[model samples]
Target: MHYLLRRLGFYLLAAWAALTINFFLPRLMPGDPASTLFARFKGKLDPAAIEALRATFGLTDAPLWRQYLTSLGHVLQGDLGVSIAYFPSPVAEVIGTGLGWTLFLAGSAVIVSFAIGTLLGVVAAWWRRGWADSWLPSTLIFVGAFPYFWLAMAALYVLGFTLGWFPLGHAYSDDAVPGWTWAFTADVLRHAALPMTTIVLVTLGGWLLTMRNTMISLLGSDYVNLARAKGLPSAQVALRYAARNALLPSVTGFGMALGFVLGGSLLTEIVFSYPGQGYLLVQAVRAQDYPLMQGIFLVITLAVLGTNWLVDLIYLWLDPRTRDAGS
Candidate 1:
């Protein structure tokens, strides 16, 4: 509880800081939102319309502190204000439409990668000095060092294009609708296949490698040798003793990965033209869509903050040593 409370408090503070920074970043940008919008119109706007636009975006009238408080209040209510690019539509609405795609693809991929990697790590550690330790690290190193975007490009080129096995891009075929129906689900999975594979391939290696190393280190500890000498079954001794200790590090990695998913595979989304938050952020920044950008930034900041709190809880659960140590 102590550990969790400390982490929770830290996350709350960090969230406040992140929100404040998100508020000021756009104001500090090279041009104001109104000017950027005006540039698009290619001419001067009428006085009445110009003032109305400024007021609509919360830019013209209110004191800075009042505006900040109002913005924070709207965030708490999940009202992210109207997107400049998608005028009259709230930023939340724009993100809501695309968030499903990001979560379905990236979230699933992260879960898959964590499962496969952790299992491999356990197996590799248990079989120390055997093929599990030897070949696994080599395999992981080969894959881990490959740049994520480049690996994705390779997957697209070979599997998607040349082999003609998977899709080239998009979440589904144009005819597909968003729903619980078989068609929509299948379409989502089909479109997800390529990006998912790329994410898994790139991420799996590091987890496996880290776990294997931790396992090797754990196996050498005096307690593990004692457990083995007690005539315990090889599997029991390996899993109940060595593997459990080795997995603690993997837990931390999994927490970090959870936080990262909210960022939604930025380069990968751009490369595949996936309409996830990451790609939308790119467009928002380019057009100086302050509302959309702020909304996305808040989502990511909250995600990271929330994930860290969860990690602290997991640590307390898994390692009793942490229970009294931090308190």
Candidate 2:
């Protein structure tokens, strides 16, 4: 209980710091988003309209500290202001439109990669001299060494453009209606396949390598040796004894990956022209959409903090040592 409380207080302080940073960072950018927008219209809107645009974006000429408080208040109220890039759309609405797709694609990829890689790692470590240990880790790690965006592009060109196997871009077939229908779901999945593959293939190696190393070290531990000496079943000794201990590091990594799923893969989404949060971030940056940028940053920061907190909770259950302070 003490450990958990300490962690919770630490995370709360970190969250407040992140919030303050998010509020100020966008304001420090080079140009005014309102002026940029007005310029795009060739001054057709006159200076008054331009100032109104600035005010709408929470860019009032009030003292910096006052504006900061206002921004913080708006965030608490779930009002992220309107997006200049996506004119007339509230920042919340813009993010909401793309958040689901980002979650679906990146979330699925993270889960699948972690599961497959961790399993492979356990198997490889258990039978160190076996073929799975010999070739699988080396091959995947080698492949993972390549740049992620490069692989995404190569795959997109070969599979999508050349063979025409999957979608070239977007979240679904243009003809498909947005809904809970099977057809819509299928189309969404179809479009997600390539980006998902890119993310998984790139990330799968790290988990596999980390788990393999951790498992190998644990297999020689006294607990595992004792379990073996007790005449436990081979499977039980391997899983319940060795793998369980080996998985702690992987759990921390998985939690972090799950948190960033909301941020989406910037290059992967851009390569495929998928409208996920990453791609939206690019748009926001290009258009100097401060509110939208701040909103996205806040979401990513909160996600990371939240997932790390959850991992700490899981630790209290998984490792008996973590509970000792309270006990």
Candidate 3:
């Protein structure tokens, strides 16, 4: 209990540090976001209003300490200020609109890949020296080292250009309107297919490699040998004894995936012109949409932090060793 509490306290401090950096780091960039946005309207806003713009963005001709405190307060209240690029709309709204697509595509892909990888790892472990056991690790290592954008590139070339089968870009076909209707949903899926597939392929390999390695180590343990010598059915021993214990590493990886669902694969989105948060982040950074960038960063950070928190809880369930230590 003491150790767990200590870990929790450290993570809490880490989260606060992350939030503080997220609040101010963007504004500390060399260029001013407000001025960047106001570039097009040189004479549109008179002197007073332009000065007000400085105040609006917390760039007022005031002390840095006061501005920092004010910014911190606003951040606590979930007011990331009006987005300079979008003008008038709150940063939250922009993030809100894009969050769904991000969660749907990235979240589903992570879960699917983790499931498939875990199954394959278990099979390889159970049937060691079999065809899959010999071949899967080599293949997974190859794929794991391959860059995600390259997969998107190849898929675009082969599946899209050469065959004209899957979509080449975007979250949906041009005609598909945003709605809850079945037709719209189908179109979204159809458009989502290629990107999601690429994401899965890129990520699945890492999980397989990690889980397979752990399984190999677990195979030589006394517990596994004892289970085998007991004359239990091979299937029962394999699953109930060996695979269950080997799954802890994979579960940790799953927690990481859950955390990263908001931090979409940036290059993949860029290649496909997908409007997920990753794609938005690229543009936001380029245009110096500081508030928008900050919002996305915070959302992604919280997601990962929260996922890790749940991972600790899962550890207690999957491996009672942790709970035993607690007592």
Candidate 4:
């Protein structure tokens, strides 16, 4: 209980710091969204319109502390202000539109990569020097060495542009209506295929190498030797004794990956022109949409903090040593 309380307090402090940074960082940028909008329109509108735009975006000439407090209050009330890039749309609403797609793409990729890589790692460790152990890691690491955008572009050119296998970009085909229907679902999956595959392929090696190395070290541990001497099945000794303990580090990595899923794969999204948070972030930056940028940053910060907290709870449940140490 004491340990959990300490962790909770730490996270709360971190959240406050994140909020403060999110509020001020954009303000420090050279230009404000209002000025960008005014320039875009060639200054045809009344000069007062720039002030109106600033007001709509919750910008103010008030003292820094006062403006910070006001922004904090509005955030607590779930009023993130209107987006300059997507004017008339509240920042929260603008974020909401891309949030789902980002979650689906990055979330699915993380889960798939972790599961597959972890399993392969276990198998490779269990059969060290075998074909699976020999070739898999090197091949995956080679593939992962290339940048995400490079692979995305290559895959897009071959599978999408040349062979015409998958849709070139976006979350779904233009013809598909947004609904719960199977056709729309299938189309969305089709569009997601290339990007998701690229992400998984790139990430798989890290998980595999981490787990394989950890499992190899644990395989020689006393408990594992004891399990073998007790006449336990090889599979049980390998999995329940070795792999279970070896999984702790990978779990931490998985939690971090899951936390950042909301941020989306930026370069990959840009390459594919997917309507995810990463693509939205690019749009916000280009338009100098401070409110939207701040809103997205807050969401991502909270997500990371929240996911790590949950991972701590899982640790308490998974390893008795953690519980004992906490106690």
Ranking by TM-score: 4, 2, 1, 3
Which tens-of-lDDT digit does each residue in 1-327 have in candidate 4?
Answer: 777888899999999999998888878878887888788889697889888888776677888898899988998898998887888789999999888889999899999999999999999999999989999999999999997788889999999999999999999988889999999999999999999999999999999999999999999999999999999999999999999999999999999999998885888789999998999999998887778888999999988999999889988888888887877
- What are the RMSDs of all candidates, in order? 1.9, 1.5, 2.2, 1.4
**RMSD over all Cα atoms, model 4:** 1.4
| Shift in Å, residue 239, candidate 2 | 0.5
Residue-by-residue lDDT tens digits, candidate 3, 1-327: 665676678778877888788756765778776677677587787778777877777787668777888887887798877776677789888888678778888888899999888888888877888999899878876776787777789889999889999878888888778888999888889888988888888787777777777887888899888988988888888788878888998898899889888876677778888888888788787777888888899889878888887888889888888988866
Model 3's alpha-carbon lDDT is 0.81
The digit string of per-residue lDDT tens for model 2 on 49-145 reads 9889988888899999998898889888999999889998999999998787788888899999999999999989999989899999989999899
Per-residue lDDT of 66 in model 1: 88
User: lDDT of all the models against the reference?
Assistant: 0.84, 0.89, 0.81, 0.91
**How much is the lDDT of residue 258 in candidate 2?**
89
- TM-scores for every predicted model: 0.93, 0.95, 0.92, 0.96
Off by over 4 Å in 4: none
RMSD score of candidate 2 (Å): 1.5
For model 4, which pairs clash? none
- In candidate 1, what are the lDDT values of residues 119-213, reduced to their tens digit? 89888777777877789877877987898899899889999899988888888888887778998888878888899988998889888888878
In model 3, the runs with Cα more than 4 Å from the true position are 1-9
Q: Tell me how far candidate 3 lies from the true structure as C-alpha RMSD in angstroms.
A: 2.2
